[model samples]
Target: MTTSLTIAQAAEATGLSVHTLRYYERIGLLDPVERRDNRHRRYTQEDLNWIDFLKKLKATGLPVRAMLHYAELRREGNTLESVIERKAMLQAHTLCVQHTLAELQENLAVLQRKLVLYDELEQAARAAGARAPRNSAPTPPTPERMAP
Candidate 1:
């Protein structure tokens, strides 16, 4: 027999807060979890595996709406149309992730260039006899600079 996990155990296994797990169910990201006769939720290995994939999607920057749509399609049962749609969505998401990685790489290069500029600015200011600000790093990287 397959051993079932308690909600607490699921949370620990998935590195998700208990509240987040409940929220996932509420948002339809997860199908309604099975419950024991006394009303405690019992999760199976399948559930754990699904949650792991969800985490990967999230980490890769898939939005909630897209994930929700994927879940809805998955719950529609095993039909050829549904499988095709799921494949299409996953392919689209893969392209989106690739774009994001490219953007992140470009943004990082801009940040590095800006840092070098700041260092030069600091040195120039010091050469002219004024102390430059000690910590002038930008808050975060963004692809705002126009690429040449």
Candidate 2:
């Protein structure tokens, strides 16, 4: 028999707050949850799996509207058209994520180069027998100055 968890248990297992889970259902990001006779939600393992997938999408910075659209498509069942659309959406999102990662790497390289420059400057000053004051470190470059 499939095990079921209460709403509180589902929230703890998914690392999402109960309020967020309710909000997700209300906003149509999630399908209506099953309920016990007392009207309390009873989440199945399938629901937990879906929630995990949702979390993955959220981690990828997929906007809520896009996620909602994906959920709608998903609920339409695995028809060929829905499958194609989902694949297309994921491909576009993947490209966007790749671009963002590239930009972050470039920014990280700049910061690393700046640190190296500071180290070289400090070493040269020490070699010249001058004690650079703690407050003598150069100010961080502004965006205008950061341009190559």
What is the C-alpha local distance difference test score of each model?
0.93, 0.94
Write down the TM-score of every candidate.
0.74, 0.84
Model 1 lDDT per residue over 1-148, tens place: 8899999999999999999999999999999999999999999999999999999999998899999999999999769988999999899989999999999999999989998999899799889999646797556645576445
Local lDDT at 87 for model 2: 94
Give the Å shift of residue 44 in candidate 1.
Answer: 1.3
What's model 2's overall lDDT? 0.94
Model 2 regions lying over 4 Å from their true place = 132-148
Model 2, 1-148: lDDT tens per residue?
8799998999999999999999999999889999989999999999999999999899989999999999999999999999999999999999999998999999999989999998899899989998867887778789999899
Compared with the true structure, model 2 gives a TM-score of 0.84
Mark the 10 consecutive residues where model 1 has the least summed lDDT: 139-148
